[model samples]
Target: MKLRFGLQARFLVAMALVLLVVLVMLGVLLQRQRLVERESEALSSDVIHQLVDGYLHGQGRELATRLADNLANPLYYSDLDAIGSILRDQKRDDLVQYLMVFDTAGHLVHDGSAEIEGYGQPMGDPLAAAATAAAGPHVQATAQVLEVSAPIRVGSERIGGVRIGLSMAVAHRFEQRNAERLRGRIDELSQRHQGWLALMLLALLAVLVAAAWYVQRLLVRPIRQLAASARRIEAGDYSVQDHGDTRNDELGDLVRAFDRMSESVARHDRDVRRMAYTDALTGLTNRLAFRESLDHRLMLLRGSGRQLALLFADIDDFKRVNDTLGHEAGDEALLQFANRIREAVEKYGGDDALLARFGGDEFVILIQEGDVRASATRLAEVLVAELRRPLDIHERQVFLGTSIGITLFPEDASSATALMKNGDIAMYQAKVAGKNGFRFYSRAMDHAVERRVHMEQELRGAWERGELSVVYQPVCRTSDGRVVGAEALLRWQHPMLGTIAPSVFIDVAEQSGLIEQIGPRVLHAACTEAVRWMQLGEGEKLFVSVNVSPRELRRGDLPEVVAECLRETGLPASSLHLELTETSVISDELQAAALLARLHSTGVKVWLDDFGTGFSGLSHLRRVPVDGVKIDRSFVADLQRDPDDLALTTAIIAMAHSLGITVVAEGVEKESQYNLLAERGCDLVQGYWLSHPVSASEFTHLLARRMR
Candidate 1:
């Protein structure tokens, strides 16, 4: 295990090391002092011993010389009592160990004793031999005694020299006393130094402890607090409390920087959250935020008996605005739409209602309080009406309508995803019914949506599987009853679903963006078939009309596609006619006019199909370039029965002729209807009355018969 040395622990450890070093130094100092004391004591004892030894030696020599002088006189005079008296006196002093006097013959005359038993006898000891042989004084010393011998002489003449011995016991006793005294003094001084050194050590330790406490309080504690604050910040608590350290140090600067960083992080977090949940252009809650809110609300209302309503809204023809005015204008429209919807929901929907932009031109609203259906319906209606009002986008008045679909909780769906899906499905239904309206979600809508989805998936493979084909309906000149041209129609022969109507699958194709592919194939086939028809007719001019979907027209490549098809099939451009509905042409008249002008310049005629069915037929005729217009089947079906239809048909024919536009009456199923169209100078007619749409071989046979 690794040891973690924190700030406080490290500080204390450092102080402990310093204290240990101080202790070691103090111990060494005390040891040195002791060593010095011992050395001084030894030196003092040696000095004292030398002085005492010198003094003892000097005294011994002086006394020996004096005695020798005195004894020499006595010996010369032959007075033995004199030497004996001096020896006794030296012994009486107690410092002498022993004293002896010998004659020139080396005999002991006297000893330092009360009895003179061996007096006048010859001394046979080595001391007597050495003393008798000495010409002057001699000295010898041992551990216990000091011996000195002096020869006595009278007037420089040797008669009978007297020798005396002195003891060193007095010098030894004096040296011992002096050495004891010096050692006592050294011991006293050493004890005093030890006491002072101990006090100093205590003072140093106190200083070290005080320093450690100060460092821990001033530095370590604040650092620990900062560490704790950092931990809190790591845990996402950006609000850090002040440590209240007023020191102008690095730590203080660090604390201030941390506080500022916390505040900055908090601000950045808030900004990121807001950007994540808000739409940049609309300033509305975005799809992610809406989905999260929906899920949360659904979870809360799971067991609650209350109901919630989800309204999904989409802007109709939003792409037209973008294509016509630019994306900037489209953005302005969306912003205005969002503001209007927000106001509408707030005013009509209860306080619990929530609104969010579901991306692009789509928005969603949630209503959970009181009469969910009524409130949602009211809000949706208000939104549709309010959004229908023209918006000033790029300084132009642009009309953008909204279609809303409302789905109720636990009725249309039980989950957020299902509710959103159903709501979107109903919104598509509203768009289908008409723009600027609202619809409540229904199970039928869901089934229809599913069917459409299946059909779209199947349609992708239909052309490859040979299930799709083009049929031709002949159009005849009304006056002569002669076939002039044929309209090419697309048919889908599904293996499982039998034959499907163009009304059903063509819409599916448009919605799924498959028409862009399917429309070109149909155009190519029609042009190829029409080339054959032109061959059959020989010198006659018989054109083939092919219907173009609005999606294909909006692609801006339709003219190029048509030209390419004509070129590939070897069909004359004048023999191929492109038919478009009024809605397709009116969606963006200027662009449609430009596209049609391009087609016309290449000698391909453009016709308006389903003419009277749209809202702006006359306006489209004026704005869009077209060579002819086909009367819608609805008006032709009831032309004789409904006077209004009759009047509309006649008025349309007259209006077209006045504008130098050819008119074709379609869906005429009766001879009477054909006769009425002929009388009205409708120019051409095509319906089951003449013949139903047939295969290429049948149409070729018809063209051959017409040539005959």
Candidate 2:
């Protein structure tokens, strides 16, 4: 059980018990000494009475007759010198206060001394009266003396008592002297006992003081130190001094244990801080730490006239490696990448540069107190080179590259977040320029990013705001110069900025994921327009080819969307042709083929749009199940000017025809281009030579003209 009372309390109680016992012993000793004094006084008084009795009884009768005759007639006994001499001989005795004699008749016959007050008359003293009344050996007391009377009788008769007077004052004086002696002796004894009592008290006091010191050293002081240590721990000072190690006691053990606890607390605090700031996988500073470090560096550079540069290094095509090899391999690749970058930083930028993992596939670095841009660019080059080295991940060789973007303090950006953002923008510019490259941040890039962001935000609401529309560019048969179909091109008419071209917004739409929303609207509008065209009494079959974005194709819902558009517009699927770019259908070949086959089964014609422009080849025709290919306008535009263009276009037409695929010639504006395409047996031609892109109303008139 825990101690309910403190050490001091228990110690005080023990001392009090000892003191109480001592006091009880002293009181008993004093009372016993007082009782012995009273007993000794009573015994001395009895002895004094017995000695007086013997003195009176042992004296001879002659002494009594002489004293009696002298007392009977003091005038006549004035001649009795014998009695005077006897009385005078005992006058100075300490036991005798006075000496006197009385007649046998109890009358004063002769005064033994002339100094007697009632001489030569009857001695009417009370002692003599009591002695006479007693008759023989009568002991009586006057106020100051005891009188012993003896009858001078021959036989048993009493003559007159010879009264001998003894002083009661003398006995009282003796008793007083003895009592004083006894009191002095008792006082002496008490002083000695008092000395012992004082010693005992001193000893008790010394014991109490020693106990207090022991408790203070062994228990109180250690407990106080422990409490102080705990307070220091609470105050976050883990490096407390150790005070418990010197003694070989429980308190010392407790102090040592507390020291261990303090050490553990300090270690745990360090570990928590490290985990918070460092990445677990790579042991590099994490994003939060990066931001904090950047802020700190900027503060340090504020007045130091030093510049800092931040670099954002993004691993290019890391996703491909991750998806192909698995996440474990991905983690290993990241670890290796981190190691290489750190090495490059240490070599080129030194310890002043900070390296951290911003997150998956992205790392950041800061160069401080130096030529920021120049050093950063040099370090970026080295880092790119280092990261390009092949890594062994899960025993599989993998090659990776880095694109770095640099932004400087007080130049490209003034704040940490701004610097990081500018760096990110420049990094994206490097990716856009080409992977495995680096770029320094420019204000133009910042403006461009801002513009892109603004356009993205605008494009998201463009469909709902009626800013988006479909412009149909007529497609004609090259042989007859007649319109047979039109390609649906998207246009953005900004409410404030007038009309925007597809090139301006389509790229932004694709990047911002807004293209998915725009794609369905375009399909629906084109289908509705085609149905409207059929409703016009032109009496000709006109196919509407709507372009599809790659993002829309990758969505894997293009077939369903097209079917819904057809169902909503009540347009026959055969009349609605969905044109997909080569890049759109080539990324996922299986999904693209499946989606295309499904669309084909729905009686919808799938044309490969911008066909000779991308990485797709004639083999894609055999695999993608497309009904036709549109020759890119770049090839068609330079038909007469560039012989290579004419040759490539002619070869495309031949290969497309060989596959029994329809050939659509784009951007055929010149007569020479059109004549050459006709000579090459191109199936369809679309360009400004026939007509620029027109609204549905204008296209209706064109169809009316063609029907006429």
TM-score of each model, paired residue for residue: 0.82, 0.73
lDDT of 1 by residue, 604-702 (tens): 998999999875557557667799999999999998889999999999999899888999999989999999999999999999999999999999987
For model 1, the local distance difference test gives 0.83
- What CA RMSD would you report for each candidate? 4.5, 6.8
**Count of clashes, each model:** 0, 11
Question: Across residues 1-708, which tens digit of lDDT does each residue of candidate 2 receive?
Answer: 896686567767877787778778767876876677677666655665566445543442334456544444332334446646656765556655555554555665334475656765776654556665665565555566665566645345444445566666766666667667766776787678778877987887788788888888778777878888899889978788766487887777888888898888889988987888999899999999888888887887787767888889999867656555567878998988988888888888867878999889999988874667779878988988888777887665566688988888888777888888899999988876766889999989978888888888888888888888889999999778878889999999998878877777887887678888888888888888998888877456889998888767666677788888888899998898888888666644666777888889889998998888654466767777888898888888788789898888888888888888999988878888889989999989988888999999999888886677
Badly placed stretches (over 4 Å) of model 1 are 1-52, 62-137, 149-264, 408-447, 476-482, 538-540, 612-617, 634-658, 669-685, 688-690
Best by lDDT: 1
lDDT of 2 at 455: 84
